[model samples]
Target: MPGVADGQGLGPVLTVPNLISFTRLLGVPLFLYLFLATDATGWAIAVLAVGGLSDWVDGFAARRLKQVSRLGELLDPLADRLYILATLIALTVKDVVPWWFTIALLGREAVMVLCLVVLRILGHGPPPVHYVGKTATAILLMGFPMMLLARFSEAARPWALPSGWALLWWGIVLYWVAAVLYFIQAGIHVRAGRAAAAGAS
Candidate 1:
């Protein structure tokens, strides 16, 4: 998720956009239940479609209505991550994608976590969301639904599968590239902080 502007206060917690993000978060478990427990592929896809659409809607609404808040910023990305993780688990369980594919994506997330930790230790919060990272996320979100469609719908299998894989591959590449950029950014900040501290001492 994108960070608030510099000097912007963490606005109120309650807002329309935050509510939309919360709704998207709730759909994550429902998606898992529909896809995994009930075998309702169609409904699961419907839930995913709504989640993806709402992702965009909430962002637009936030900007348009000036309802952006710290909580909304957090909730938006949290919802996206939860949906991606849920879909990955479901896809792995169904044998639609290989275990390594899932792990590779998750591994990128782990790297991000480490980067955040390193930054925090240096008295810095997370850096602003990079455009490349946002693009990767958008691509992955779109790719997963197409992959599910390709897997379950015979009619869509021909085109959806190839296109889905293409998107996923591109998304993964960009995902790792973003991770590397974030890591480098963190290192630079840490080094700069230390240099200043040393000079001060």
Candidate 2:
């Protein structure tokens, strides 16, 4: 969603909500660093859980604290993407998840981002964050913890492996579906904006 706020006045960046968003931005790299440094399953689960918590915390603070800024809106999704990307990379590196999964996840995100960039250049606004998108993200976040637990838990926890795999696959499917929807919605917005602009002239 590059430059979606170009002409819009999103207000100052010092507000509480924007501060939370900044914190989320910082958290993304930190989470990645933690995962990269530790090979322990326990550490992975802990850091991932905290990363997920940061996702929720920033949004909650933004809305409740009434400090929402355009920068915050922009950075939130970006942070989420970065966090997911890091986990996907880590999971692939550890062999807990297949390489195909990482490729697909990253490919979808790349496509969505390209669409957003194209839309912005075409004079269209950023696509609305659809419900499907939200659900997709939630599923992925939930899947990561389950996957981590599966890796760390002992043989006594028989359900962890299967449940974690199931959740991970389901989340990947949902994310793909959501990515399709995002592109479709972006196309609609672009067309509408173009038509409006043409008619105005």
Candidate 3:
């Protein structure tokens, strides 16, 4: 495993691995446009699946090709959030997924991002992706598209709704756990930073 220290000069951005992430970001608007403009839920789901697969592809390529970029890491999550948030909002407008659930999920994501941004401004880069956070994202990404499909397709309705809801609940749980872990991790780093500053003074 390559630590930040091990790869001082190696750039992770602008590589094949990161190109996949850029593709995912590009998919975000496409998915949103498809869902918003068309009644083609099946097509939307298929496109969303392609976007999701791009997520996996980028990460795998990064590891295999050693092209992991800091920008890619940030871009990947942003793309995921944009895609999921748009779909959830669209569904809510159509009276499928509840507004409350969408709000809750989006709120968590927003707060975490704000926290990371603040930390970065304070001279600490965004924290590494915790496993729990990654898992939560995967669940949410996979679940939301299915949930959207169920909203418009009767054939996908039976299992997709329940399964999507189940995945949603699990994702929520994992997100909260990850949030707690992030808080603890941030607190420790904050204290350490403060102590170091005091020592320097």
Candidate 4:
């Protein structure tokens, strides 16, 4: 918050927070290799935990150490998205979760991409991250590992699947709600930009 002035963007890309973001981005491929190629669920879950911890760590480092950067802002979310995509693919391939669930999540991302493309063509910035969206992401991150844990042992499955399913479903609902807010925000951005253009004209 100290260094982050507005959603417009921030300073140089060379910073600790950006470094952390870079490290997080590196984990995605490694996670996929462990989960999909080697079938190493335990190791994959550990890698995921690191990814989630890094998500928090990088933000804290950015604010507390005043190392926030425009690159970090962009890359942090990108890393999270890739992690989500990788997790879905790995789990689905392992038969831990259904393919349709992955489709639903990816479909939301596809819609967002289309919205962003439209916004860019019209000369408007994409909407800033909303708290609800962040919360949904965090909740889903927590649930995903638990979901894998469900597959770890039959004894754990009874409680783990239910807990994970509960969080996962709730997170999906929250994610869609955030999508609605984003669309509304996109419209607002467009209208504001048009109003500013008309005033200038």
- Between candidates 2 and 4, the TM-score winner: 4
After superposition, candidate 1 runs with Cα above 4 Å error: 1-10, 191-201
Candidate 4 per-residue lDDT over residues 1-201, each given as its tens digit: 333344455666667787788898899899888887886878988898788766677778888887767777788788888888888877888888898888999898999899999999998877887878877877778788889889987888999999989988988889889999999999999999899999999
Cα lDDT tens digits for candidate 1, 23-134: 8999999999999889789999899878876767888888988877887778877887888788888889999888999999999888888778878877987766677877
- Each prediction's RMSD over C-alphas, in Å, is 3.9, 4.3, 3.8, 3.3
Error of 4 at 112 (Å): 0.3
- Whichever of 1 and 3 has more TM-score, that candidate is 1
Lowest lDDT 10-residue stretch of candidate 3: 1-10
- Candidate 3 vs candidate 4, TM-score winner: 4
Ranking, lDDT, top scorer first: 1, 4, 3, 2
* Candidate 4 Cα misplacement greater than 4 A, ranges: 1-10
Off by over 4 Å in 3: 1-12
lDDT tens digits, residue span 1-201, model 3? 332332554344457766777787887778777778877667778888787656567778777977677766777677767767776787788777888897888888888888888888888866677788878878877887778778777898899899989988998889889988997888788778989999999
Pick by TM-score: 1 or 2, better one: 1
Instruction: Count backbone clashes in candidate 1.
Output: 0
> Which of 2 and 4 is the better model by lDDT?
4
Global Cα lDDT for candidate 3: 0.77
Candidate 1 residue pairs that clash: none
Best first by TM-score, ranked: 4, 1, 3, 2
